[model samples]
Target: MNKSLSRLESALLLVAPLLMLLGGVLLVRYDDQGWDGVLAAMAAHPARSDVGWLLVAAGAALTVPPTAALAALVRARRPGLGATALVLTALGWASVPAYAMGGIVMEAMAHAPDRAAQVAVLEQFNDGRGNAFFLAAALGAVGYIVLAVGLARDRVAPAAAAVLIGLGGAGTLLVMAGPIRALLLVAVVLLLAGQAWTVTAGRRTAPASAVAAV
Candidate 1:
């Protein structure tokens, strides 16, 4: 791919995550962990719920290319670990469509005429496929952690940055409170800095290693 294109995509990866996180925050505010809460929120703030879901879906989709490029760099140095990371990342991100569908369902639920209709929509989503969402989300967290570890092990990235990446990814996944997720900002700064160091190192020695990864 073109170098400029790669850079653009990397920039997208950096920014797109903010959209997903912001969307998540929006959803959290409305869905008070119950059907009644969801119906109420939808009745009161349906538009906000719609925007939140859209942002999350768009952000997740936009990051795919950049994440793939990052995985390729990791693979170039260590094939086995790279393959594992790629699989995990791909599988984890596979939840994107499911998430998108979730937004539609929420909308449907919001427009539902009554509590019983809303319950039906919610229950249908609670099917076997629903179980996969949790697993995929968890895998995505682990995937980023593994990718950072592999990059560091292959000497393509700073070990400290990799460590920070792992911590940030894990922390974001484990923390439930809305405020605590602000750790994402700290993580992103370290991520950008670490990626910058990796690119500089690659340019100075092995240019191929960087591959314009952000």
Candidate 2:
């Protein structure tokens, strides 16, 4: 069989969505209150907070294998949507490091000597450099939507899964804070479903990626 995954990648793909889902749960658990809450959580439960960040980021980055497989699957049938999704998602992953940096900055904010210092740092970061991350995030969201639609249109995944993925993609694009950010958990669930669909249903469409069905 023409396999896209070499066991290790397949395993990682299987675990990636779950890890990210778990991370989202943890993130919402602690940083649901926005920047204020994130910094607070950093001080209140540093380990859990950091772990959540790592899980979410790592899971997202690790999704490469499955994403590649999905891209390959859809690309063969719906080249336009598939290519757009692949590019946008790759761009979206760019936010990973930016997100990690944001977490680090939040930790610094938590430890900052005073409010003034925190504000100063926040201002500096937000000046321009930080604003650029929004583009990456937005692009990533667009990519998810495109991929979801592509897969569904190509019959690689169900329409229900596509809807979930589209909704999740929209959620990721929103600027949420407080308990509202908990919506991210929904996105994670959709992500898992979408990824799972790729592993199972999508595999049927392409013979070469049987091993990478996830």
Candidate 3:
């Protein structure tokens, strides 16, 4: 069972990055319009908007497996920090599907005849008072940093992996620039590479005790 589980995790870790990358590409491709122009843009490019949202939703859902796998690996080495990082990152990822739902709303707005109504819907989507959004952002930022540090200190993963995770955490800030938001994809790619390395290397070097614990 243990070996089987490890193999499953490794597979997930490998696939997660690819999904994230594809999703990011779709998002960037469809995001020609800024948030302010989302309705008009969706109306103009309905197919792109639909496909992008679907990809985003699928990619976001795929992230869960790798997140859990990484957390489990880190937990084997540093329990407390690993658990905290896992929770935070999980919460952050959970919010991604909500964005997909918002995309649905955008699609609806695209068809609405009243421009004023479309703007109101967009505003609500933008300015919603849900704490989940803030929680995901704040926790994810801190979680990735802490997870990177823990992974480095425990030597469970390569130093490069830690660096990539750290940079990914920082890349969140680039979202404000819209076009530069591709930084998120870059970050995900780095993370995917790092985690893949960790799984392969960790399995080879990990002591029997460590493997059992993991």
**For each candidate, C-alpha RMSD in Å?**
5.3, 4.9, 4.1
By lDDT, who's the top model here? 2
Candidate 3 matches the true fold with a TM-score of: 0.79
Query: What lDDT score belongs to each candidate, Candidate 1 first?
Result: 0.60, 0.64, 0.62
Model 1 has an lDDT value of 0.60
What are the per-residue Cα lDDT tens digits for candidate 3 across 140-167? 6677787788767766566787777656
Cα-lDDT of candidate 2: 0.64
lDDT by residue (tens digit), candidate 2, 1-214: 1143356655665687687667666652323224565566677766666677688778878876567666667888667878888888877766765675566557656876676566566657666787677677787778888887876876666778667666665455433222454576666666666555545543446543553675
- Candidate 3 total steric clashes: 0
Per-residue lDDT of 46-103 in model 1, one digit per residue for the tens? 6776787677667667656776666676777677777777777666666755665665
Candidate 3: segments with Cα more than 4 A from true spot = 1-5, 28-36, 169-179, 200-214
Clashes of 1: 0
- Give per-model TM-scores: 0.73, 0.78, 0.79
Candidate 1 minimal-lDDT segment of 10 residues = 172-181
